[model samples]
Target: MKNKTYVLVIIALITLSFSSMAQRVDRTNFKAGVHAGVPFGDISDLANFEIGLDLGYHWALSELIDAGLSTGFMNVFVNNDTVDFGSFVLEGDFPNIQYLPVAAALRIYPTYDFKLGADVGYAVGVNQGNSGGLYIRPMVGVNVGRSTEVNISYVKISDDYDFSMAALGILFLF
Candidate 1:
């Protein structure tokens, strides 16, 4: 009888501990960051680099998962290249390409401080004649304190022209 009672107490304690841990993580959070990107593929031929800012809000779905909304602005700087305008050759610096991306974000935590995340949505063009369309980003990050993280990600925007970049950033959580 004493052995059975001890086992039951141990089971109760374990259950309570799990419940407390779940409660601790089921909360809302906001994160913001800035990133610098290196262009790749065809984009590299036209754009030298990219810089961006991101903001997001997340609702904890479980201890290991979160769903959120994210929005950001990215600017791709044009390279100095000459474009043949058919009648003449146009040279000098071109206008920078800009995008405003809005996305649905999801994050999964495999460990306490490590996470994998993805965002999918649309990037709206800010410049006339610049077409923007689908936007996607996949990232991996490690949390460095209660409210800070460092991340590396790949971002893609597909439209009349497609662009891809590798980005590294820091995020602050609140």
Candidate 2:
């Protein structure tokens, strides 16, 4: 009898929880954004800066959680036509390191105006002779107004080598 009573209590609590969670209905949304930043760490020696466009579709998993798919294009510009490696200098054109990121994204809204998020997936090398690698980004964001958001993020990709950058981005939701 005690075991059955405990089971009944658990089910009652769960039902109440779901009913409260269901009070707020959220709709699917689209996000588009752009960002620019300078290359840092290992790739800094080979590249100057990067700019990218972000596109994503998100569905509300709960009142405060969003799950989505994210994709973006990034181009890291070559530093110079000539590169110096301390002991030697070579002169010629070098290709910019360019890649596209395809990732699973999740964001949590701690408050109506604040959010934290992350993306993990693969970066596909789109530049000639470039093979892409794993992609990861963690971000913090602020809601600017009704339909705009501003965010700062760290971008990292590891292939045969690890490359990273710091970016500030803005988005318009539709």
Candidate 1 lDDT by residue in tens digits, 26-84: 54388998999999866776787999999999877767888999998999988889755
TM-score of every model versus the real structure? 0.81, 0.84
Itemize residue pairs with steric clashes in candidate 1.
none
lDDT of 1 at 153: 98
For every model in order, what is the number of clashing pairs? 0, 0
lDDT of 2 at 154: 97
Model 2: lDDT of residue 11: 100
